[model samples]
Target chain A: MIKMRLLNGQPQNRISMADRAFQFGDGVFRTMRCTGGAIEFWARHYSHLEQDCAALGIVCPSASILLEDLSRLRPVDAVLKIIITRGETARGYSVPDQLLPNRIVQLAALPAYPEQLYQQGVKVRVCSTQASWQPALAGVKHLNRLENVLARREWHDPDIFEGLMLDRDGFVIEGVMSNVLVLSDNILSTPKLEQSGVSGVMCEVIFDAAVQHGLQVEKRAWTLDEIKQSDAIWLTNSLMGLLPVSDLCGRHFQSHAAQLLLSGALKQLRQKEKFAIVDLAGMTKG
Target chain B: MIKMRLLNGQPQNRISMADRAFQFGDGVFRTMRCTGGAIEFWARHYSHLEQDCAALGIVCPSASILLEDLSRLRPVDAVLKIIITRGETARGYSVPDQLLPNRIVQLAALPAYPEQLYQQGVKVRVCSTQASWQPALAGVKHLNRLENVLARREWHDPDIFEGLMLDRDGFVIEGVMSNVLVLSDNILSTPKLEQSGVSGVMCEVIFDAAVQHGLQVEKRAWTLDEIKQSDAIWLTNSLMGLLPVSDLCGRHFQSHAAQLLLSGALKQLRQKEKFAIVDLAGMTKG
Candidate 1:
C-alpha cells in the first residue's frame, strides 16, 4: 500500500541525507495505531517520545505541533509512525551547538495478519541474536533497532509471528517487536527492561489493566525455561495489541482464563478511547 | 559548509522517509578521506562495505557503481560518507519478501583540527557509557551508533580529543571514533574486536605496518588500568591516522621512541597510497 509521510509538519516524502537519523540512527521513534479517525493513546505516546528525546538531549517538538501534523493526514485505518532525530550535523557524534530536532510522521495502511493466528495464538521461536546491555538506552523506543531487525531475520517461516530475544546473559528480555508477558499462579510477570529491551506502550497498558483487575504484577528477569513454565505467554505491542503465544521453542501453552481477562480489559480500554474494532478477518490472506 | 550528496547514484540531497537507514539503521557505512579527487583506501573501504552488507544479507552494490557515484563529486579535500541500507520497507522489522538495497554517498569538507594534536598527542577520557556486546555486529561499522553518540555526549570539553569506551565487562574496547592501540615492552597490542568495537581499516593498516617493521603485535583484551601502564597509547581510524595519546584520564605518557617508529612506518604506508600530506595547521581555529 502507498504511504503518506509528513516531514516536520509538512507533506514531504524525503529527509536530508545529513539528518542524524539516517547518519547515526541518532533518534527515537514510535509506531502508533489509528482507528476511527483518532490516534490510540496519543498522549501516552507523545509523553514517551518526549521522555526519550530528553534522554538523548534532543529537543522534542511540542505536542500541539505533532497533533497538527497528525491531523493533516486523512483519517483512515492505518499505522502512524513518528521519528524525532537530532537533525543534521557535520560528520561527528557530538551534538551541534545549535540543533533542531526533525520530526517525521507517516501513515501507512494497517498491516494485515492472519486473524486465526490471533485466535489460535502465534508460534514463536527463540532467536540466536542476543540483545546487548545498554541501561541508558534501555526501555526507550530509540531508532538503533538493528538488533531487532537481526532478530526478526532469524526466522522466515510464515507460520512464526515473532521471535523472542534474550539478553547476553541468557535472560528472556522481549520479543523482536513486542514486550513479553508471562502468567503463572494468578500473577502477571514481564521481564524487567532495566538493562535492555524496548518497554512497549501496549505492555504498559497491559500492566495497568492487570493491576486494575487485581492481578499481581512482577517485573523481573526470567530465564527461557522459567518463561516456558508459565501457565500462559503473550506478546504485547502498539499495533498488535495482545497476542497469546501458542508455542515457544517447541513448548506449548493453552489459552487460559487469565488471557481472556486481560484481553477483555484491553478491549474496554480501547472502547473508552473510541477505537472502533475493524474486522481484520477479511483482510487476512497470508 | 554545504555538503553534496548522491542517493542511488543520483545527485540528490534527500532520501525517502521510509528508508530503512533512517528507520531502523538497517545498514552499514564507511567514512573515507578524499584527497585531490582520489579516495584514500577505496579498495579496502569497499571490501569492508561489501563484507558488512553481506553480513546483514543485503546485496552490496558493485564497486563500479559506487566508483561512478563517487566520481561525480568534485573532491577537493573532503570526507566521503557511504551508507548502504536494506532499502525501504513497510512498518515492520521483518525483511520484505523482495528487497532492494539503497546506496547513499555524500561529501563534506574535512574537519580541521589542531596540528599540535598530531605531534603532542590528545587527552582522552574514559566514557561512562559502555559498549554493548553483540558479536553479530562486531567490527562491521554498521549504522546503529547511538552508543557512540551517547559516549560523545558524556564529554563536551574541547581538550578531550576522544572518549575511550569499554565493553560491558570493563575491558577497554575502542575510542568513540577510533580504534585503541597500546605500546608496552616494545610490543604493540590492540583490544580484540571479536565481541564488540569497529575493526577500523586504519587499524588493519597499522597491524600490517607493525609486522613489516618487525614489531610484535597482540590482539587481546586489556583493562583500563592495564592500558595506563603502557609505554604509549594511540588511536587509529581512516580519517585520523595513528594519533598518539599523550594523556588518558590524567595519566601522562612521554613520547616514546616506539611511537616514532610506528608513526614513521604509517607515514610510509600513506605515501605508498599516494595520499598527499595536507597541512592542516593553518586551518585549526577551534
Candidate 2:
C-alpha cells in the first residue's frame, strides 16, 4: 500500500494507540481531491480545518509545510486525506498543559465514480437514525461521527447511493459525510451549519461559485417539508464533486438550469486545475 | 505496559487506524474492578457488554474466552477496560459487509481512592455542558462520548472530585463517566437511561443491591432541583465503589446510607470471586 507520515515528520506505518483521535474520536479531518498533483480548494479546506481545530482546541498544522509535504506525495491524480488529532499520550480527557498535536496526511487513489450519475443524478434514502446536535461540535468535520456511522449501517443496498440526515430537532443538518443543498425558485438553499453539519470543503466552493455566478444562497432550517417543494436536490463533497439527486424517498425531480451551470463551473474548474495548481503557499489560516 | 489481543482476537500493538471505534466513536465499553485477581460482578459486566453489543449490532465477545483472558491479565487489585468497537473497518459512514469486529481488553493498576472520602464524602461542580439525548443509544456505554470528553476536560483538581452533567433539556443525566443517584424521603431515584447515560457495571450492582435490600429504585428524569432537595447525593461506578457527594452546585446533602450500604454489599461479594466468575465453560454467544 502507498503510505504517508505523521506530522512529527516520522516515517510511521501506524499511529499510537493513545492518540486522542484513536482513544476518544477527538479529532477533525478533511478529504480533498488532488488532480495533476494539485489539490482543489486548498485555501477553503485548510481554513475549515483550522476553524474546527480552533473550536475544538486542537493545534493547527502549518499550511506551507503541509502543502510542501502533499506536493511530494501527490500522484498525477489522487485523493488526499488529512487528519488532525488532539495529539497522542493524553491521559484520559485532560488536554495536556503542552500538546504536540499530530497530523496525518495520506495520498490514495480516488475511487471510481459514475460520471453519468452527475448528469442523471442519484437516489437517496432518509435514514431513521438521527444526528444529535452538539453546538460545540456542529459544522466541523470532527471525528465524532457515530450518528452517521449508525445511519449508514441502516441500509446495505448499492442502489441507495447516499443517506440524508437530520438533527434530533428534525432540521436537516446534512448528509452522512457531505453537505446538502436544495434548489427552489431559482435560489439555492443549503442547511445552515451554525448548529450542526459538517462544513464540507466542496460546499464552500459551491457557495463561492454561487456568488460569483450570480446565484443566490440562503442558510436556514431546510426541513423535510421544505424538501418536498425543492426544485432540485444535490449532495456535495470533495470526492464526488456535486451529485444531483434524481429521486429521494421515491419522489422524482427533473433537470434544472442551475444544475447544468453548476456542473459546467465544476468542469471548468477541473480543466483549470489541469493547467495550473493554484498556489496555497501564502494562504492565511489559523 | 501490558497489552491483550485485538477485538478479533488478533495480536496487534495498536488497533487499526481505520477501526470504526477510533474513527467515529462507534463502539461500547465496560470498566470493571478486579479484586484478588477476578473482576467483581463479572457476569453483570459481560451482560451489559452483551447488551451494548446487541444494541449497536457489534459482535459480542465469547464470554468464557473473554473472562479467561481477563483471568490471565489480572493483578491482585486492578482496573479492567474492555472496549468493543463495531468491529468494522474505517470506511467513513459505511459499515462494510465483511467485518472482523475487535475487542481490546487491558488491565491496569487500580486507582487508589481516598478511603476516608467514602466516609466523609466529596464535592462536585455542575458543568455548563449538556449531554445530547439519543434514545437509539441510551443506557449503553457506546463510545460517541464527545460530550463526556468535553465535560471531562472542564476541570482538573484533586480537591474537585467530580462534575455533574445535564442533558440539553435541563435534566441531570450523569457524571462524566459514572452513573448518578439521589436519595430523598426514603426513595432513591437515578436518572433514567432512556435517552443518554452509560448503564455502568457498578451502577447495575448498586441497583441490584438496592432491590435485594428492599429499597425503592425509581428510574426516571432527575433534575438539579430534585438533587438539591435530595436527602443525599451519591455516585457509583466500578472504579469508585460509592462516593457520597457532600455538595452539588453548593447545596449540601447527607447521602451516606445508600452509599455505605451499596459499598458494603459489593465488598462482601468480592471476598469470594473464584467461584464468582461468569460460567462461560459451555456457553456459546455467537
What's the CA RMSD for each of the models?
A: 5.8, 4.0
User: lDDT by residue for model 1 over B1-286, one digit each (tens)?
Assistant: 5478888978898888778998998899998888775677778888899999988888999987877677666566888888999999766888886699999888888877667887899999999888888888988899999999999999878888999999889999999999999988888999999888898888988988999999999998999999999989999998888889999999998877877788788888776664322222122221
Top DockQ hit: 1
* Model 1 Cα shift for residue A48 (angstroms): 1.2
User: Please, what are the lDDT tens digits per residue for candidate 2 over residues A1-286?
Assistant: 2345444544454766677776688888888888765777777778889998887878888987667556555345777778888887623566676787887777677778877888888888888887775666778788888778778888888888888888777888788867898888878888887766788878777776777789988888988878867999999999998899898888897877798788778777665543223343223221
Q: lDDT values of the candidates?
A: 0.86, 0.75
Residues B41-145, model 2: lDDT tens digits: 777788889999888888887886777655545345667777887764534667766576777777666777877788878889887767766777878787777
Report the C-alpha lDDT of model 1 over A87-200, residue by residue, as the tens digit: 998778888777988998888888776677668999999999998788879998999999999888888898888899998889999999889999988789999999898988
TM-score of each: 0.94, 0.91
Off by over 4 Å in 1: A273-286, B274-286
Give chain A TM for each model in order. Answer: 0.94, 0.91
- Model 1's DockQ? 0.66
